[model samples]
Target chain A: MNHNLPVLVLAFPLLAAFAVNLLGKISKKHVAPWTLASLILSAGTSLWVLKDVLQNGKFSYTVGGWMAPYGIELVLDPLSALMLVMVSWVALIATFSALPSIKKEMPGREHLFFSLYLILICGMMGLVITGDAFNLYVLLEITSITTYGLIAMGKGRAPLSSFNYIIMGTIGACFYLLGVGYLYLLTGTLNMADIASRLPALYESPTVATAFCFLIVGVWIKMAFFPLHGWLPNAYTYAPKGASVLVAPLMTKVSVFLMIRIMFSIYSPEYDFLMHLGIKNLVVWAATIAIVGASLIALTQKDFLKMLSYIVVAEVGYMVGGVWLANQEGLTGAIFHILNDSLMTLCFFLVASAIAYRTGSSRIADFRGLFQKMPLTMLALSVGALSVVGVPPTCGFFSKWYLLLGGVEAGQWEFVAALIFSSIVNAVLFYRVFEVAFSHSEEEPSLKFENSRILETSPMMIPPLVVIPVVLLVIGLSAGPLVREVIRLAVPAL
Target chain B: MDAWLFEIIGKFNYWIYVVLMMTGFYAMIRKNNLIKKLLGMNIFQTAIILLYISMGSKVGGKIPILDKEQALAGAVQVADVVNPLPHVLMLTAIVVSVSVTGVALAVALRIYKEYGSIDEDQILERIGKS
Candidate 1:
């Protein structure tokens, strides 16, 4: 049972996805409990796997008892194990808010939505755990296809945005497949470790370089890294509240994790960082522009959800830039930021959904006097805002600090400047929203609830919004130990 | 010049696939109609599938199945057998592409229902007016 835990972490949600759909045919009410129970089980199993990994160092499980290099394998190193925990737990927490939001916003599509939701979670979990390059491509498609379905389920312009995403996402996944094909042609192996072991001798070949470029570019498009980010803002902004809360936090973060795996695991640091110093510099500079540019664009958005989506783009820049800084600290910050950013983004999206549920608008102007109407929700937003701005005592501050240290150490002053610039822009953006929400407006009345007895937000929604901010503070305070124990182990030796 | 010509002709398969890929990529980017874009995506994926299939093929290679008598006699050379892994991988890729195309068409249908037009410009113009 202990040996099977890693696969079990994935199996629960994959099985639950089909089960939920079938059960939904009988009654819609079974969907939420079924999805949540499976996610909880998956998260618990992931934590157990993380504990087992930390103790035993690293291990790989070959599917069907076949040996590595030939059969599909699921690897559980500190990094992947940590990512499993993060992805599962975040999926679980996001579902708490997602349930009520789906019920309210989607209305009667709960079964279908939750079914795709579980499958998306399963895909992300499989992505982090799988050791085969070809397997990763399949899981990427699974995630992308489910996300497209979820996004298109939204009313109005959503299907259009999802269609655009489908085009870009397919291109990205195909590029990755093409890259893997090139690698297989050269190395004759689809297993990641096998490919890596065989890659050093062929590092100087242009085919190898081209393959690396394709893989990185593919992941960048998937993660919405700057120039390839055109599909993100609109697709995420127009998605139904339930879907956005889950996809916004997990999708890009998992892709960044994939990039890290490719960089340090598949291709050695000597080849990625040392041999390609020129390309490294170019990517870092692009990340710098992505950070500053996305933040500036985010500042220009009047719709609050659109602004948050752009912030997600800039946050991607932070992780990408940090990783490209090519130091231990930078990698640590990048991995740690994956955890912190996902939590904070979940917090913000949950709060946005709750507010939208009440007020029926996401425009900044419509948020006037919301603080009085929804105090707890507003407080959660404040916590999330401070975290995004990298204020101290939230998890965001620690990761940004590590990223800054890495930038300074690497002598990338422009990237460092961009980081600081984006944080300030975030501060201004959140402040403007807060100022509107807090200020008393004589012309506009406070938002009225349909039922006087009910709370500001749904009971289902309130728990995650409240829990996430607390988790942020807890993670912030324990950053030192987390870095020393887990994240440090997760970072590849540079 | 003779060697360069030989190189181009010898690897002409790759060149053809790259051309096909570029054409699909062009349509995916430049086409106005959503259905055309979807077709472009299919073309792009099919080109990749063909590229992978080409990689598994050899000029004089047999299908991966082995003759038991030849295998027992130890007369089968590894090079004589065409690689089967790429073919199998492409099968999975084909399924994924089909699913992606199916989802794309469904979304395209939804887009038409919502905006009453499938052309990018018309949809955007409608969105702006609304």
Candidate 2:
């Protein structure tokens, strides 16, 4: 049963995506419901797998019943288990919410949308599950290619944005392959555990150093560190609402996880030379720039989703900086922030999608009197916005708190400043939208605004309002316990 | 520095790998055409493939075709063979690289049809106006 589970998890989605693509010809009506149903079941199975992991400590399944170090292996420990559940849960919610939005937005591309969506989920899951380094790259490419396709489905300028994303993403994946090549050249192995055991002896060689550099740069691209993040804003802004909601939450976070695995697991912290290479300080500085720069840029955007796009860039910095701090608290904050930021970003983008659905625009100016126009959605948006601004009682605040504390504990005051600057900039950005949403439009309709419906948009408003707040509350309330657990799992990596 | 160069070049395979990587990177950065850029990406990917294959090499080793009779003879009595693992891995990586390139080319063709240009600057100009 254990031997079969990993293949089963991946096969279900792989088959479903292919089926959806084929079935779209039979009847377009069968596409959306079938896609959603498969995702719901996928999410349930992922949760069950997570439960099994938490209870059993760890489980290893050798693909094709072959032994490890030779055959493909799928290992599920707490970290990956947590990630699987997070990816699937967010994906399920995002997929369901996407239905009506895509229905209206793309009009003719819903079947393709659902198919690419399923493929993206499968790719992310494959990245999380596969214990082979080379296989992870294969899955990463799958995710990137499918994502570019999905992002291009947006109306205008989307294909251009998707084109830029393809260039950057291709470079990123190539860099990762190069890095893996370096490691394989040194050790002649692709399995993570095998490479881990073999790597320390070769650390003195300059080839190892080169490999380290290659790996870090590669993952940094995917993680979208400051200088390399040129492709992100447009990609997020111009993609369809469904694509943005789906990709924004998991894509960068998964890359960061791979980075953590490489930095700590593949090359353990006990490597004396790696510590002396000033890699930590380099990461700290890059992350600081990313945090402050992205936040400030986010403040300058007029479009609501574009502004949120820059915030996502800033959020990546927070996680990268947190992890690079290389201490228990720092690592814990980084890991916890993954969950926090994923949910928070999901909420933000979902609300944006809902607003876009209602107003047919995501321009800040168009949101004037949105509070009256779409009360439930705007309320949810406000909560999500406040969360992004890192206020208490929202998930965003707790993660930022730990991140700030981690900086101080590591005596990295500049990073603390970055976090504070990020907070202020986020506040400004969120408030700009909030003001428009709250203010009354000068030319009010003759009809009473109170006559406006309770829920603004169907299939869109409901998911964000329900899923976003509940996630926010859960993170805020259970932060202490969650932080403790993240710390435990992060120990091996840090 | 001379000693370093000699040592690096003496391993001709590593030198070839480095040259291939540099060529690919240069083309990717310098090329104006999308197809040229993708060709560069292919070259860049192939360099890694060479690197992996080179890694699996052993001094005076034969191809790793497992002989059931020889293996059963004894654990100590064995053919000194090159590692086949990296080669196998590279085959998978090559397939993935090609698939990504194929998909990317398809997207690029679609992009060209949509915007009526294949050059980055012109494409950007058209997209910007949109």
Candidate 3:
């Protein structure tokens, strides 16, 4: 009965996206509810897959009943199971909040908005599940193109940013495709598991070395690792509110998952070139600079949404540094941080979406007396803010702890310093927002929210904002069991 | 000297791809005009497609189609057919590149509409003044 779950999880979204577009022509109000029903169904299937993977161990589903190497397959394991559930649920919540914003921002075009939205989700899920290298590239482009369309829907400077995204995204995808081409030339296979089995024999070959370089660098560009992150902040910050909320959270995180998948799964754990060339340390060192520089830049941004984009860049550094630390603790920390970071970033971006919905602004100075006007929203924002600042009993704190330990274990003092420095900088960044929010209340107490339901935003937006912070806390508290039961299985064989 | 010349000639296809791809790469980074950058991107994608097509070629090989009667006779040889995998992959890739190009052109049109020009520096100047 559950055998078709993997393909169903992917196929449902593709079908729902088109269905939503068609339904939009008939009725505007139906788009969000229709999309929600389908999203919930897809999220449930993802959970079922997660449960199945946890129980029976890893399984691969061959599409169209064809065999592997000749046919594409979806592999569900503990890592992908974690990502699938996290991304699907977060996407559902984001879509829910997006309803109010879309109605306000782009009223007549609701169907097309949801259509691109659902396709982006499909691309991300497909990126996570596919076990074939070439299939991964195909899915990545689907995600990228949908993302470009979605970002182009933003108001002022969006189209230009979308064009910039097209350039960088195509280059990244092409580099990845070229790498896969070289791999096929050498290994004569495209299935990831087959490639891994055949690769050790060619490890010393220059062809294999070049292929590895192209593939990982391509993924780095996608994830916006330090030097390659030029397109991310401008593209995301200028994107429409709804697009930024979802893309800001899932896009880079999924790319990081793909990076991990490629490095450890397709190449085997003994990818000793990092050690032989000392490039692992070089990667981690680069990550350290990304953390420091992004945090400092984030601090200077007056626009809250733009600041969050830089924080996303810094968070990318955390995961990259942790993974490249090349130890069990570091790897576990990196994988755990992906889940933690996605939830928190979704929380943060959702609040930004809500802010844009209400005041029609996310400028920090424009938020005068927001604490009094929208107390609940500010409260939710604080939870997100504190998590990013690495406060305890929040999920971010635990992930940072593990990452710091990993840094120490690897004896990388520079990374250790960068992590601490960024956390402190993040604290200052959020506190400054709070200071501005509270600064106005002392003198004029802005418009009092005696009937604050207006401040609460539409009823549709509140549920996601309230529910996400609670989940953040729950995930933080249960992080221990999560590592034991789930993350341990997900870490690389290395 | 003869062997050296022959080896270089044998790898001529790869050298051509490298040259074409680099030309595109240079234009993408060095050009200030948006349309030129778009053209460069197209060139870059076309070069990669050509690289994949060349990889599928064989001097003595025919098309990759299988003969039904020859299969029944059990007399098929692998070397007789050029590799079809890269060709199939590149076909899908060409479609993707075309979609990317379409989206990019649409965005470029929008940029021109909004800012009245696609020169990177002028656009930035307009954005700054606003």
Question: Which candidate wins on DockQ?
Answer: 1
Model 2: residues with Cα > 4 Å off, grouped in runs: A1-7, A442-455, A485-487, A490-494, B1-9, B58-62, B66-68, B74-82
Task: Give the docking tier of candidate 3.
Answer: medium
The stretch of ten residues in a row with the least summed lDDT in candidate 3 chain A is A444-453
> Model 3: how large is the Cα RMSD against the reference?
1.8
Best model per lDDT:
1
True contacts kept of each: 0.95, 0.53, 0.66
Between candidates 1 and 3, the one scoring higher on lDDT is: 1
TM-score of chain A of each: 0.98, 0.95, 0.97
lDDT tens digits, residues A106-200, model 2?
A: 77667788888898999998898788888888888999989988888876778777877877787788888888888887886889889989999
DockQ of predicted model 1: 0.93
Looking only at chain A, give the TM-score of model 2 against the true structure.
0.95
Model 1, span A215-245: residue lDDT tens: 9999999999998999999899889999999
Positional deviation of residue B36's Cα in model 2 after best superposition, in angstroms: 1.9
Which pairs of residues clash in candidate 2, taking residues 3 or more apart in a chain or in different chains? none
Off by over 4 Å in 3: A441-453, B1-4
